[model samples]
Target: MIEKEGFAALVLRLRAEGVTDLDLLTAFEQTPRTQFVPPQFASDAYSSRTIPIDCGSFMEGADLAAKILSKLQVRPGHRVLEIGTGSGFTAAVIGRIAERVLSLERYRTLVTAAQIRMDALGLRNIIIRQMDGSSGLHGEGTFDRILVTAAFSAMPRFYADQLVSGGSMVAPLILEDERCMMVRLTKTGSRFEREDLFPVPYLPLASHIAQHL
Candidate 1:
């Protein structure tokens, strides 16, 4: 568990970083980041840097996580999909607000670790699967909200197609300059509208191009 002072410090830092949603901030403060991190790095859990997790992946910064979750605009009865379930921390946070959270992780090690963490926290609303996040899960559609924690060169069309009308997606899109930009995409009729939110850096999702020779 994180101390109150440490949690307060995290909240202040996130607020300064432009995470203004009180509900998101409260969720971040309530979740114990330390528990999701490796035991040796527990002390640094509240720090503002990304800490390495299993399978060469790392947990996103607390501020970035808060910002992404804030933009998700989840509600009590919303169905959510989360790509790249790192330590299951983000999924757990979404589970708290959304009616159901379906998260995917490609790495078996990370998937196992995340499941363990979620079970320990007794977060039953999240269903984790070991599958490719870039391609997205099949047979699930009409999600009220979708989130991709990993960076991508372009928005995955599959994800946009799965969103329910009026649903929104928050992801880090890698531009030509190799810089990452946080973008929010909201479904409007048969099309989706995009809004650039902020600049961010995150590990890129393992794409098909990388998987094949």
Candidate 2:
């Protein structure tokens, strides 16, 4: 468990990492990262590194999640979709801000763990689905916001099509060099504009191009 001073330091570090949104920061502060990690790894939960969970999945650190949420411009009453629900911490945070959150995890174990965590936290607005996150949730169109936690070589056209006119998405993108950048995309008319937010390392999306090849 992070002490008050330690949690404050963590928040300060996140702010330095460019998470300046007050509401997002508060959500991060309120959610206990330790509760999302496996019992053995709980001690390292507050660290700014991905903590391994069941089935080789990991819980993204607060900094990465904060950046993604901030860039997505999440707001109350918005419908959000999160690809790769590892620990449900991010989904819980999104649930606090958005009207509804649909989070998918490819690994059944991870999905179960996330669901348990959400239930324990009393997060009622999040729906956890065990499915292929890369292909995305079929039939759930036109989301107010979308956040992909895993790194993808190419943006899914289906995700873009699902975005509401002014909706936004934030994901770790794998570039030509195999490097990853936290990229934010926002829909405008028939196209979406991309912005390079920062660098990040995330578990590769289960449906990555490498898998297809």
Candidate 3:
């Protein structure tokens, strides 16, 4: 398993790549990635790679996570919403930097597992919920920031509507032929602006609706 010093080195590497926020850096340092990683991959926890969780979902790749967090610019007064809680690792990271984190997952099993992991780590500010994240949690009030761990093919309007004015959002956008890009969005008044960034590969964000007869 990787030690604390090794994790620090990873943080430094991220800083070199422009993830210079002290709050985010400290969060990465304090929260052990292994806590949220699957037991089989615990040894490589500190490495900058994607780790798979159960149910066909994968944790956000380290590079992508760093970029999203740094770009979100989560402040102490911010309430952040996470669209995918793969392993709960990113949620914990955001919780340490922001005031509170509310994560939505499409899979109920993953939500339960993530909740258990978060509870074990004593991360109280982050809440994981089982819901269709693509639909957005618009009924739950606005958020100061939003981070999406998976890729969306189209702009999620509900997320934009739920964002507070001046708030920022970072997400991975999927395109055709195994292509994807990191997108940063800012909400101003009733409008939203999108800024497409460097390409990155991330698992697709699933969309679904429930029905009962």
- Candidate 1, residue 97: lDDT: 79
Q: Candidate 1 on 1-213: residue-level lDDT in tens?
A: 455766788778877877677666666766788888888887777777788887678887666677778778788899999888888999988887788999988777777888888888888989998777787777886798888887888766666678888898888899899999988999898777999988987777785322321
Q: Each candidate: how many clashes?
A: 0, 0, 0
What lDDT score belongs to each candidate, Candidate 1 first? 0.80, 0.79, 0.79
Q: Per-residue lDDT for 17-38 in model 3, tens only?
A: 8778878878887778877778
Clashes of 1: 0
lDDT per residue as tens, model 2, 61-144:
656666677788888899999988877888988888889999987777777778888888898899998777787676976799
Regions of candidate 3 where Cα sits further than 4 Å from its true position: 176-178, 209-213
* Ten contiguous residues with the weakest lDDT in model 2: 204-213
Any runs in candidate 1 off by more than 4 Å, and if so which? Answer: 208-213
TM-score of 3: 0.90
Candidate 3 lDDT (Cα, whole model)? Answer: 0.79
TM-score of each: 0.91, 0.90, 0.90
